[model samples]
Target: MTVEVLRYSAFPEDGAGGNPAGVVLGAASLSEPQMRAIAEAIGYSETAFLSPTSESDPARLRVRYFSPRAEVDFCGHATVASAVAIAERYGAGVLTLETNVGLVPVSTRHDGVELTATLTSPATWTRPAGDSAGEALDALRLAASDLDPAYPVHVAFAGNKHLVVGVRDRWTLDALDYDYGALERLMGREGWTTVHVFWAEDRHRFHARNAFPPGGVREDPATGAAAAAFGGYLRQLELVDVPSRIVVLQGRQMGAPSRLVVDLRPGSDTVEVTGTARRLTLTPYDDVDLP
Candidate 1:
């Protein structure tokens, strides 16, 4: 059997910028190796494979995420892309996804012009980076003085673990040159998915860049998972007031400017990440035969 793959750019800025993700709507028959091969062929940071939970319920799905290198527990951009793709085909509604981490609820809406998806993450938590902070800095070739005093380095999690590093200025965030081998090794040892380096422009606006070595990507243009983790970091540190809306601008330095909106509500442990996804033209390997 041949599986159909769809491409979509999630968290785009005016439908032009965002991270591209591959979506496989019917993947119940595909094996793990086939999924990995398709993801590698697509060459995106991540691809989402979704299978229905039951015959009657199309909205409840068992979703799996895979990067070019390996399978991941959860992926936000791909989730958003998959939600939009499903919404376009079946009309906008809510979806329940059973991921490797836990249950994630995603909702899709059509605002007349475009379709957008919002995913409520699993329970979030944070912990101090401890000795690993220095190792991360060394790998990034950054000094302690470059870090923002207000936001300390910590490992934050929404769906997957991310090291949240706050830099003092935008220039430092823009000029990110790191030792890939060292950072990859550190992340692998630490079990971190991405290094979320960000600069806070204000209480409501921020800029970010994510280094995803494990995913075999040097940098991600727009990372929704990291965005969700950063929101949890702010809440954990008591940096933001409840019921706050934050706009994270990313991918500008990479030439693909993207935007992600994070919402933190009162008394809610799960963070809500909202973004728009646009379908892309079919790629060469849109249809691939099972091995």
Candidate 2:
């Protein structure tokens, strides 16, 4: 069967900015291994697979996420990319996705030249800070003083868990290097998606980076799942009031800059992340030979 993979840069205002994701429309026939291989072939951080599940049930649609190395429960960039692809093909509207994590809702629209998607994440949960922070610091060769006292560290989760570590200043956030093997081992043992390193410039603005050794990546330029988790982390810490929204800027240091906007509701426990997507060329997916 023929597969049309659209490339979209999620989270950035300009098409050039943001993380590039592959959207494979109509991926019903592709198997899990096939999807993983296709993602590896595409060489992006993550790619999305979409297939019709229940036309009678509007909320039923099969969605899968594949990193270059493995299949994951949830992926924000792929969701944004898929939503924009769907909006471009099926018109701007609300789309429901049935993912390995749970049901996710995404709304999309076309504003003349660009397409945008806002995804309401699955239920969120936060856990007390773990010892991984100090270990992470050891692996990165950093000190406790580098941490931002304003945002205490924690393991934040929406669909998956992420270690959220906010730094005290830009200098620390800029100086990033770590022992890849050690970090990867620790992340795998802890079931972490990424170690989200951040610096809050202000209430509405922040700079962030994700160490994604668990997924076999040095770092992710744009990380939507972590964004949602961090939003929860702030709320759990009572750092932000309810109904607050924040923008996260990532990948700038790496040169593939991205912008992610996260919205939080005071009484509710879910966070909404919004961003834009544009096309990137890649080999179309095929089950028989893969992409």
Candidate 3:
């Protein structure tokens, strides 16, 4: 049997920009090893493998995300790309994904030829990074003075854990340099998916760069999970007022600019991350041995 994987770029209106992800539909029979091999072969930061849950629940599907190096609990860009792919084949609407973290509800819409997907993340929370702040700064080769005092460093979680640090300026955010090995080790030990360093452009806008060392990617053009977690982080710290919609601009340094919108509701714990995705022609890979 042959499995098909579709390619798509998420969080950009242009087809060439944004984070590329692989989406595999009808993956119920594919084993964990097979999925990992497929994801590695695809060579994207993350790939999503989907399996239909039950005929009784057309809106629900089982989703798994894998990076080249390992399987992750959740991935935001892949989820958005996958939803657009599904909507293109079927129709634009709602989809419920059963992820390792929890059930996430996603809504899809098509505007002209562009498809946008919004996902409501699970309940979110944050914790102090403790001694990791020094390690994070050391790994990133940044001084404490480079940080934005407005937003303190914290380990935040929506669907996945991220170490969020606010940078003092966009220049510092753009000039991101890090020790990959050191960061990989630190993230592994702290169970962080990415180290998110951002600069607040204003109360409603921000710029971010994510270091995804554990995923084997030096940087992510667009990171949905990190954005969602940051929304929670902002709310918890009272950095932003509730019932607010914020925009995050990313990937300018890498030349693939991406835009992600995060919506937070007052008195509601869930955070919504929305972005557009463009489908790409799939590049074929050698067949993997399936058990």
Candidate 4:
């Protein structure tokens, strides 16, 4: 089975910006194990596997996401990367993706070096968890004063659940060192996918980081799914009114800087996450075992 793999930097139009993802055009012949191995071999946060489905269904793609450690229900940056990659070669329009979560519609448009994608998440919303901010602070080894009083700690869900903790300043965000193994255990016991650590800069801007030890990645440079869910949380808590959007800056300290945009609509929970893509140097190899 041969699949054409393209590497893309999602959430940023620049070639060096955003998160890197493996975009597979056709993986119908690849097994789940093979897909997982390929994703691991690529060593990105997540790799996207796409197979032909049905055009009549309006969802012409069957998509699966895989991290190095396991398969995931959904991945936002990979979706954005795949959309931009497909649009660059196949032309722009609304593309349907059948993910583990549900059907997702992605629309793309390109102008010069600027490529944009709007991904409709899987009917996202927020829910208050059983534990309060106190427990979250304990797990993160942070004080209540470190958190942004405006944006409280809450669990948000788009395709998966994430603990959203907004900090007060960049100094707090830059000094990020958490118990990785402990966090994995806590997230596993709590059924949380990631711990979204963010710092709000202004009304519509945020400096963000995500701890995803559960998925075997210390952090993701630009997490599209978590960004979407964070937008939902902001709306649910009245932190920000609807019909607005947020620009998230992340990964600078890690050196693979990325930008993610989260769009919100009033009276609705689901938010649109948009970004561009640029091809990277990674390739998909068959008959290779991944470490």
RMSD of each candidate?
A: 1.3, 2.2, 1.8, 2.4
Which of the two, 3 or 4, has more TM-score?
A: 3
What is the C-alpha lDDT profile of model 4 across 1-291, one tens digit per residue? Answer: 445567888876355768888888777878898888788887888999998897465338999999888898989999999998888777888898999988888999877667788998877777766565466677678887887878867889999888998888999899978878778888888878888999988979989988988778998888999998888888877788678888988888788788888888876657899888776754433244432
Candidate 3 lDDT by residue in tens digits, 206-260? 9999999999999999999999999999998888988899999888889889999
User: Once superposed on the true structure, which residue ranges of model 3 sit more than 4 Å away at CA?
Assistant: 13-16, 282-291
Q: Where does candidate 1 clash, by residue pair?
A: none
My TM-score estimates for the predictions, one after another, are 0.98, 0.94, 0.96, 0.92
Candidate ordering by lDDT (highest first): 1, 3, 2, 4
lDDT agreement of model 1 with the native: 0.93
lDDT of 2 by residue, 138-232 (tens): 87667898887788778899899998888889999999787899888888988989989899899778999999986778989899999999888
> Which pairs clash in the backbone of model 3?
none
Q: What's the distance in Å from true for residue 183, model 4?
A: 0.2
Better of 1 and 2 by lDDT: 1
Which pairs in model 4 have colliding backbones? none
Kindly give the stretch of ten consecutive residues in candidate 1 with the minimal lDDT sum: 282-291
lDDT of 2 at 17: 74
The lDDT for every candidate, in the order shown, is: 0.93, 0.84, 0.91, 0.83
lDDT of 3: 0.91
Could you arrange the candidates by TM-score from highest to lowest?
A: 1, 3, 2, 4
